[model samples]
Target: MVWFLQAAAAPALMALAAGAAISALAIRLCAAPVETAASAAAVLVGTDEHELDADDPGNLGGPHLRSARMVRHGAALSADLVALSTAGAAVGLLLGVPVLAAEGIITVLLALGVAMLAAAAAAVVPHRGRPGLERAALQLGGIIPAVLGGAAAVAAAALWIPSRYKDLRFEDVGLENFTDPAITGGTPTPRTELEPMIEQALTDMGQWVSQTDESQYASAFLDVLTLYSVTPNVVVAIALGLGVLSALALAQLLGGAGHRFGGSVLRAARTSRTGGALGITAGLGSTALLAAGGIALLVLVTAVLNVLAAGVPSLALALLAHAGLGALIVAAACAGPLLAPVLADRPEAAVGLRNAAAAAATGPRGVMLLSGLLTALAALGPVVSALQLAPRAATIWEDRSLHALTPSALPLLGGIALGVLTVLLVTSAVLDGARRLGANAVVETRASLLEGRGRAELGELAEMVRRAAAPALVVAVLAPIVAGFGLGPAALPGLMIGVALTAAGLGLWMIGAASTLENAAAVIGSGRYGGRGSWGHSGALGGAVLTGTLRAAIGAVALPLLLTTSLVSALAVSAVVGLSTDGTSHFLRWGVAALAIIVALTCWVIAATAPEVDLEDGEAELSTPLFARADDAPADTLAAMDWEVGDEDVERTPARARGKRRRGAADDDGRAPEDAKD
Candidate 1:
């Protein structure tokens, strides 16, 4: 519940996210043919179509070819994102917006993770593999960029071309001298997208010395940051990142099938391929890591772990939503690389492996588009509000919005809710089982490429696949449970209408449960209580909460109890218990909201006072001089004197001399020069 509250978390989150995002991108792009062929024999072409060894995992050639192919896709997604973030970082120097620098990197990666989870969820419902709504989404996505770019280009040309030619003569045109605004510092800039982010990052880094706290490296760190911000490192790195990402995205999406050289790899046998299964495994790994991050972020922001205690199911649902979106964006980018593979080596097709590898994203240039879409859809406003697209997006950020959602407090009788949630979890599992029923059902008649592999090897391979897919699958399914607790009540009803997802549950169940058990054991095994003061009050509160939690757990698993009474009757008892306890005394004094505010303020104050940020001021000076004259600026340049300077030179404001009037002994008026001047 309190992870994002820490400073300096953005970069680490992004680094891991980028690594994970590319895994899916690699599989979707370069090794998709193997995946498709493994799924259904009909997807292959010519000789390869009939040669399909559906379960082999060897059809994409071998480990070498598969891996080699994935390199392009992996590089495209990672490098592009890095470049974009770097550019944002650099541009942030100008606008004082630090978050912009890395915002694309984190949000986009998470968004892709989210998208994939969505696809997994959709898989829950049965479908023929025909394009439906996605076709429109693709068309809309494709058209918007083209139209916007064309419109912008035309406007720029119309505004600039006539003016250039208006003053043109053949002689003048040939010898044009350009004015450099760089020297004069009149350069305009984008909005302050990066300032706050960078400042926050800087503050977090320098926080040790901000208050009474001390660290030996604190001063040194500030000095290094000063050097970094003051120099062109930020600018150079950012510009390089932006330009490179832009070029790569364009080249990959627009690259021709024919090589710059006349030669091609199209006729190369599929045996030349490399390890394709690894990409899927990588995709799985990346998905899980991303889910963890998304879950952590939500837990911190939503106060799920607050003393008030939110509906646990709600937290689970939100995390899943994030995972689903992130997966989808990543999946879309993967489409470019995978499309040709899906086509296979058909006679009519000339597409090759190399052509599919260089693909990457989703907005301004497809950054976080899914998040925007989700927020727009989930906003608790009217249809008229939806239609008014650009009318003050403040509503989109309101507390009511999912982006700012505050989970409903966990009811005292929430044990029944857990049981209900468990039932929903069972249902989601059933749906997912149905989803896997038809995936790649046709195994080829040929001896399995993996036939000689031992039982252990097959089991290991199956385990890898399962582990890889588990994060996304688990998130998707658990998210359905949250929906039952009244999260998102959109189109789907009686199933997945809302989400109550919390990634904390997954980690706790999978990883933290053992430690939790260990703690309980140690507590139970202790000879006697010694830490508490003379009075037992200190431990008593935690004890009550712990024992109460145990009771609730017992109630949750007691199916006979549920059977003995109707659901309504059971619910009534739970409600009675909750109402009875609602007004009773408890440990909370300031409450969770107050604590959250205090923590936020402390973090902000810490960041606001961070050292080594003065270097940014210097960088600003180098980028743009205030663009207005300061009172103390040097008087006008001597070289470009006005034609009417004789009159203009007469002090315009005589009462306020440019220089302080001199009063000294050197003045000779008559008697004693010093006395006369005085």
Candidate 2:
């Protein structure tokens, strides 16, 4: 009772400490800004300038001094000071209090809303120009994350508090001890402290029981790998690393293309087939290096895994299995590009499809499968090996060290992690190359498809769809490889869930991207507000597709795994409880099931969402400010704008565009055109 009371009170104490610290920090930070603003306002109000009645513009040659501006400015500054202080107080209180309490999520959400509104109010600060709005925007962006972090902390505290109960009251539960019959017997066991009646009951009930295999290490391992079956922490780490890698690869590849191809490629692709062809060729040539890098990456991972697997006795087969699996993944990744163009309707959609296809083809499918398999096998290997060695060894456990079981598993996990990173780098490269090629190809094909009307376009679209669908399908096919290596004989079903989610998500994105882009031009040509709506529609579509993909993937994996694991665990527990079993049985029957369900659901959600977000939507429009604004210009206005720009283009036309090509145009400096000019 006392322990429970202490446990419950712990969260309150922690909350108080956090709240107090936040309050102090907020108040301290607010002091300087508040004081400075107040002093400035007081000076302005009391000065001779205020008595001069700037409200009379005639005083400066007009009627009213810009008193309206002055009042607005003063009010804006005052509002900023007030908002800053209020936000600070809220943050401090939120932090100081235990956010994990029942009210925490709501409290944090409320605080977020208040803080954002306050930030907006602060933006009215009197300024001479639009730059003040920009300043406010920057501050708003920075503060939102801080608010989110505080909320996450609260949620985390809540998650942790309840979990602490298991730690405080629970004892270490072991598999071996639970299986031993004599130790659980009614009489006191001579070998250990286990009550004998319980041991006898288990024995009579035909359950094996033992008291060994109690290494804290195994528990930690289980906590790490098995806790969240999908989107485990390891997977999230890998996904984040991959996302970053993809972004970098994209930047580098595009930057290089821009440097080599020149700006005309964009207009050329739009106007002339010859230009489109040349641009596409140039893009492909540039992107080849990146794809080659990916190929090398896959090969390296395969070689490394083979080498390491060879080092272990029984693990060699597992390594071979992983290699075969990797071969399939690599094949699919390499092949996906070839298929993407066939599946797409628009050029850009095709490019995106190809990019996703490449990522799907090349990503951590093999490594994930192999790692999961190895982790499972590693877990079971010990028990199975121990049981097999039980009769032969001096002591069943003396010779059946967990070390024997862990060798295959530990390296598998490590190798998978390393392999995942390698795959990410290469996959990113493949995607970058695929996008470059696809973009160029798309520009070329879009006209062809549009000109041909239905038949040829439909054929092309079907082909592109097939291409886009291929990589994800291949990934799905290869998931069984993981199932084969994994521990539970039925583990294949779980692996399938994850694989299906990934494939379905990829497919959905491909379809959505295609459908959305087909309408981009029509939507953007409407009007300024229409353009905003178009862009918003595009963005929303992209977001929804990505979100749906992630959610589906996560749900597919999590729902089934949770339902299966929990139900199975419940059944196991009920059986033991019905038999009136020992402490081991009690823990298994009750405790493990809940943990399994929680872990499963968590894994599903995390695994599904992180990897395949809307990078293009986030990055592309933002990069080209004009493109971002393009949708806002009405068709007539855009035509007029183009005519005006075209006149300038004609006046400043480069001699090269008129076929006045200069032989050996390259500068003696040997740098690319842009750099050479510099």
Candidate 3:
């Protein structure tokens, strides 16, 4: 009854303690800022006044008159408020010593550590290149280092403290009394008495099983157990490792293939294919690494959980979930490369790969079907067990100790997650770089086969591709990290959705590029061969057509992949755990929403680009400012203009008739014959 009462009172006591802490901190926070503001105001206005300026509006210098002065005062108050709030929490804990002086020090250190963690938590939001983001970043930067320092100090204290009770019998100095070479047959004494030794052993074992406290011995034990689990589960370990490697390879294959396809389309286009190859290569490598890392991590984490659960039906279900997550992760990883060709206006390459994949998937559809069915059956083990004749079997399979078993799995899981993050970040950085390169290429000059002007355009294109790739890669990687850090698992689905969108965008870019290249080549060739009448259409229109097609295909593939993949599924699961909601329903809602958005965006983009044809042409037209303005000007001025319009300026005449007409006109006749008209 006493214990129960104590337990019941504990919750209320804790709540009261927490409330007191907050109240004390708030008081300090409020007081410091008020004092600071008052001092600043006195210094600025030469008097203490709550208002900024005196009654005169024109006199800005007065305490009661100037808005700027008031603003400064406000700023000071805000800064002081923050500093005091943080510092108060630190000081309050120091003042309130719950235990002995030594324990109090420990408590204060722990409080400081908490403060540091809180600061870091506040900084997880993205602040890069955004309005006010820099300020946030800078503030976070300052806070994190301080927090880290505090954490280090706390950790040192924690490490120095005694891990286990020194009162244990084995620690007694009297154990040394048992030392005797002759009686013990030269064996050294254990130092502890016989009865104490037995008691201590049992106590140690109890501690080990219970994981009662953090200690050097406990940590070492856990580490050894983890290592043992990893070593013995060789099959699972190998599978996990291979999963990562294979995912990487697959991503690379997709990226490379996409890159190649883009290059091919660009080559057919007859435009400069400067960074296309590099983009393809980087894209492929990045994709592969990310995909493999994600897969390896999913497999490792799920496997650990499954084994920990003692092969309960839940394990199979978890594995199935993990497999789905792996697929999504790989899909997300490959998106950039897969969409690369399309973005480059390389429809042929994109189409070829797309067709090939679809055909392959469909060709062995039965195998896929059988495999899926078997997997489903395996996953249903838990449900089947619930309906089984042997209830004892289920009970026998109940989860045992997590301590010994989870160690191995945790490391593998952490490594996998880290690996995936590394790959994604690297890939995103590369892509972002490429994107910037491509954008810059618009102005970049190169050694061209055509005129100086044409060379400039090609150079621009090359530079654009090069610059853009890095940024694209950066964006790709950043998304994953931001998702993981800021929103935990919920952020993952966002990435999948974002990747899908990006893939679609890239695809359109490729298609448009291919069309433009083809048109340019045709135009140049026609101009050289005097085939203007036969072929004089603008390249921009064709490019637009290609871009539309590319974008469409990307959207088609991306939407499904994003909706169905494991990466998003994992995120959904995480959301469920963190938010305590139904993951399946949440994911379904998200997928449906994404699909709708994709459909809407596709329609909107297609409609917008359809009439204009080549979206890039408008930009090209803008680039040729003088030429465009001239074309738009009066026809008379255009005719009189000295600027060359290529062969378009030339007069037309039949081959044989022109000479005969000239010769007849030259003959000494007052009036030229009907056939000799000039």
Candidate 4:
């Protein structure tokens, strides 16, 4: 009850905080971190600081005492997307260039330059090619996975296309309808209305799903890959462009979800075992709820979309399609936790799980927006080919999609994404804010009073609770790996989800405790430096500005990559998946994908070396800037105060709390110390 009461104070503070009243706009934009901070504070107020010791993990530092910048946390995270793209782009070009060479469209100079770029992208993983040629060779092995998958996709396409898409020849379809009438007589009548056409297509699709073997889905996917790949240099160009766009979506995922995950896991480690366990349980429940709620939210908005779709059917169709994809992502994310047992002990489960998240995040909104712009240009190749070149015996398969699922749907989704974006900007912003608020209030208030302690026990209790949670963390991580070993090749996709959930769950457990600490410190800090004339407030504001700008700068980098690498993996992965027929080669195909993910991530890790700095100030330089200096950090990672504070400001904070903040704080270096007594 008290927790909710404290959480209720957040909006009031937002409204009452000195300059907070100045802008609702600012509140909306920055609500994510602010809400997170506030929620963290309320938990501490309700906490029992007993049954723990200083050696506990939750005693580790949090972002609260020193202001955490959204930028410093996730600035370089987009490197993951870039790495995927270059590896993919290399594979695509290597596979496609030969076709061009056969056609005599390729030049020596062009091939060399393309090769160099790909090599460089591959080499830059983790950092300088320090992993040596052997590692590079391993990364080069990444191409094997995609190639293996692509070959399988092609084989799959061959068997399925003729059986099902054998006859897509419509009288009114293609360049034949748009060409000069003199050659093909007058325009045909009885044109189909798009709504009915789409309806019929969807109806057929439903029927297909009900009756067809599941393997046909991959066969169906391969159909799209064929068109893109047959285009010579165009495929490479298109892939590079998509890879660029994918970087943005990836960055956001790492910053938003990954950051959340990392923080949660770290905090869980810092909390009491029982509290962490309960926190984990609650988090899983929330994840399920959020996913369900997101779908329900989308479903509710669908009526509004329906009205719009009635007026502009194409636009609505795209939104509807993107909505379906979004629903799937949410479903997958939520369900993955339930399936965590399947992911344990995989060779590179973490890498695969991260892939799933990145794939989901980029596919719906990001892909739709970027690909929509290129729709006109993308259409030109097919239009020109269909009109100029005489249709080959097998050309219909190349030029046209089997059904409504192909080009039109992708472009429509993209268009809809762009169109509805501005309107939904506020929607997303409000959502982030609301989520932040709801998460803290519920968790903290309910779990605040686990066990009570004495007046003299204030500081001791907080430390105890934090440490208690530490030991249980090992079980959380290892359980999945152990469970996963009992599984097989089929676990590939599930592994991705499980990894995601494990990360989410671990992080989820820490939320209440971390939030309690950070929010409390923030509250105390706010009051201490609440004055408009205070240096602390001014410093915080400056840090906020710097971080906001830095984040924007990172976004700027992603914008161009959005153009190139967004499709890089899609092209590469699809091409690979298309090579194998569905089901028959399921193990082989997914195994290839797993290998690719492992190879790419492995190269990035093993090849990249982090050099330690012996200098004292190096810790500060290495640490996230704009955050509080280690010297100023509270005894507890989140704050110096116990659950209780006094009427006198000085009494609330213990001088002993600042005596030692680990060797890292005292000596300014955690990574390098002779005695290594942290």
Clash number for each model: 60, 48, 78, 56
Give the alpha carbon lDDT tens digit for every residue of 144-221 in model 2.
332333333333333433332112211211111222232233333332333344344434332211332434333322
Best by TM-score: 2
lDDT computed for candidate 2? 0.28
Question: How high is each candidate's TM-score?
Answer: 0.23, 0.25, 0.23, 0.25
On the 0 to 100 scale, the lDDT of residue 86 in model 1 is 26
Clashes of 3: 78
lDDT of 1 at 66: 36
Better structure of 1 and 4 per lDDT = 4
Report the lDDT tens digits of candidate 1 across residue range 1-678.
013422244334323332333333222222222222222222221113233222244353233223323442354334434332322221112121121222222323333333343334333432212233332233233333333322332233234222221122212212122222321133432223323444555556545236423222343334323322332222222222222233223222222111111111111111112222322222223324433443344344334222111222222222222222322233333333223333332334332321221121211112222222122111112111121221222233221221212234232123234434533442233223212221221222122322442211111223222322333223322322232222221111212112223112232122211112212212222222222121121222122222222211221111111111111121122222232234422223124224434543453344333221121334544412322222446567878765464546655737455333332333333445445545
Off by over 4 Å in 3: 1-207, 222-440, 444-678
lDDT of each: 0.27, 0.28, 0.30, 0.27
Once superposed on the true structure, which residue ranges of model 2 sit more than 4 Å away at CA? 1-152, 155-459, 480-483, 486-678
RMSD of 3: 24.0
What candidate 1 gets wrong by more than 4 Å, as runs, is 1-283, 286-348, 351-408, 411-436, 439-678
Q: After superposition, how far is residue 369 of candidate 4 from its true place, in Å?
A: 15
Kindly list the per-residue Cα lDDT of model 4 for residues 1-678, writing each as its tens digit. 112322222223222211211121122223333333332332222222221211222321122212223221222222322332222222222222222221111211222233343334333322112222322332223232322322332233233222221122223123113232322235542323322443355434545345545333333322222322233232222222222323223223322222223343223223312343443333233333323332233344445544533322223322332222222222122222212212321234343332222212211222222222122112112122222222222233222221112334332233223223312222233333333333333233223332221211112222222222222222221222221121221121222222222222222222222222222222223344232223332333222222222222222122222222212211222222233213234355446545544543443233223222122334544332212232465356556557554458545546565344344454775454444543
